[model samples]
Target: MFTTKIIAVILCCLLVSSNGLQPSTCSNQGDGNYGCFDIASQGSCTEVSNQPASRDIRWPHSGIDSNIDWAIKCGDIIAYKIQWFSGGWSGWYVPGVNDMDTKVNNGNGLRRMWSYFYDHTHSYIICKTNDSNKLRGCQ
Candidate 1:
């Protein structure tokens, strides 16, 4: 029984460490409270706003999900996009003070982040790509 218990505890520890667990910090930014999902892992990345008003949080992965309330102020035409290993790009999402969240999936979570510039016609173009940053296994 002692050996079994020891093995179980070791396995639990390994699982926790391998899952890329981390702490998150939240604060009020710009118009409302916002944060960055900072992820340093094998195949995931994000563009985190490291400002005094912004906060930091661990990016979600398989079986783990996250919801974000983008309190976008007027005249700010910025949005976030994500790309997966197999699903490709997920286009820009203008949360615009709405609640946006990512779904849990088997893929290596989100792999990329993109900034968009919205035009008068309600269309947007890729304005920036955080290509210089790469996660653990992301190319």
Candidate 2:
């Protein structure tokens, strides 16, 4: 009876572990690179390459739309279409702009920072790649 009980307990543990109990998120490449879904289909690579390199500024804002909000919470990679400082070529979206900006602004600060920009930038979207947390399912 004792042996049977032990076996049963072991089986239960295995079952629990196999069900992906921990919070896991999927990746874009399937190798678990990014937390947000793959936006490759939406031309992420092209968009990133075409963006002009510029000095990006970090600004904090709140109450961003849902699409941007989701990415900030769970995205792995950041991409952006940066506009140059000069006139014209003013609006475009960047994938990881918020993440990058946040990192730069914080700069080893002790305070915990929450991403707040979602509306100030135009056409910016967050790609939801798979993460170990499994929060988002296959898209």
Best by TM-score: 2
Q: Which number leads on lDDT?
A: 2
Question: Mind giving the per-residue lDDT tens digits that candidate 1 earns over 72-104?
Answer: 211222454444435354555654333244433
lDDT of 1 at 131: 44
lDDT of 2 at 29: 53
Q: How high is the CA lDDT of each candidate model?
A: 0.36, 0.39
Q: Candidate 1: which pairs clash?
A: 41-136, 42-137
Query: lDDT, candidate 2, residue 116?
Result: 23
- Backbone clashes (count) for model 2: 23
lDDT: worst 10-residue window of model 2 = 110-119
Candidate 1 local lDDT, residue 128: 28
